[model samples]
Target: MPQLKGIKILLVDDEPNILRFLEIGLQNEGFEVLTAQDGLSAITLVKQFQPHIVILDVMMPGMDGFEICRMLKKTENLAVIMLTAKEEVEDRVKGLNLGADDYMVKPFSFDELLARIHARIRNHFPNMWGEVVAGPFRIDDRRKEISYEDKVLELSPTEYELLKFMAINNGLVLSKAMILDKVWGYDFNGEENIVEVYIRSLREKLNDREHRLIRTLRGSGYRIDVQ
Candidate 1:
């Protein structure tokens, strides 16, 4: 397995024993971990820590996980996994509808939770993973290589960065200025049309001649939708 050393995780649960257990276990697994016993603390820590993933408990005394999850989704790009004692399908559906990336019932297997954590972060926080998976695109940071639909792409350093940026932010529409600042440097003084050039190159390589995978939003910049 790849190392998840630098990833930040926030665990929110009112139970002291559960929080202590998870905090210890996750730290041992190399994740930078934090624990919040209530929704208010969790929200505060989220702003301060900006963790890549949040494991939230559903039944706190006030501002339950569903409400916290709702608020978390509105302003954050992080992944949320709901932990609840309830086993009802409706509860799970409600959590999912509220934008939780995953749900786990209490007394769950720790190994399974860890696996789900890996999966959720890999899919949502691609840049933090050694090997990133976004839809059909796979990026191996160690090898500095990427493949689309299992076919390897021959890309320049610039193109690789551009594609990686867009893939990680899969469904979000990005403006030209945003892409330029990210792929190029924040201080890049180059023309924005350079983005157009690289996009064309990448499209040709992906066989996206009709621009289905990466769509141009006309006035807006671009968005990648491999799904």
Candidate 2:
């Protein structure tokens, strides 16, 4: 079986070589992928392919990376991971501040990227029907309560929603928009930053338990797969 199976990944970049390299790497890890060469194409693929995650490069011609991400978040159901060629701290902070689940600078190890992806997956999908039990991490969706070693976990409403959805999806890649639609409901009028804020809340609650689940797929959406 594929190591990271059952997730549809959308890879966007203006460069053919970069697209090919990322595609091969993701495919080798057992992912189903689609590619787009520019901003317009990326938007089309995001809507049509409905990838679980997006691997977006920030330097594409015409639209550019920030604009694409802004567009995706504006749509109200897209989850995005950004890729940068530079290690500018502002860029990284900006991506996270904009509701991007994760961002990585180029020349980084593929393994590091994979690890982040896997962590996002597991964090986002830990159970089914809003519940899962792995030792002390007992999460019950019906009550929206998580407990470690039988101790009750105090989680915010947004955090609860994140955990609930992740548990239900198990090993599926859930785009940011998908998460927003399901968790915040279709009527939520808040900005996309809401998603990132909730994710951080959830992460803080989970603490060191964070791992390969609920991972980010750069330029794509989020996933709930175990490494």
Number of the top candidate by TM-score?
1
Residue-level lDDT of model 2, residues 150-225, one tens digit each, is 7786887777767756654555677778888988889988897677677666666666356455566765666655
Q: Which 10 residues in a row give candidate 1 its minimum summed lDDT?
A: 1-10
Query: Could you tell me the lDDT of residue 161 within candidate 2?
Result: 66
C-alpha positional error of residue 213 in candidate 2 after TM-score superposition, expressed in Å: 24
Tell me how far the alpha carbon of residue 137 in candidate 2 is from the true structure, in angstroms, after superposition. Answer: 21
Badly placed stretches (over 4 Å) of model 2 are: 76-78, 125-227
RMSD of each: 12.6, 13.1
Cα TM-score of candidate 1: 0.59
In order, the Cα lDDT scores of the candidates are 0.90, 0.72
lDDT of 2: 0.72
Clashes found in each candidate (C-alpha, N, C closer than 3 A): 0, 36
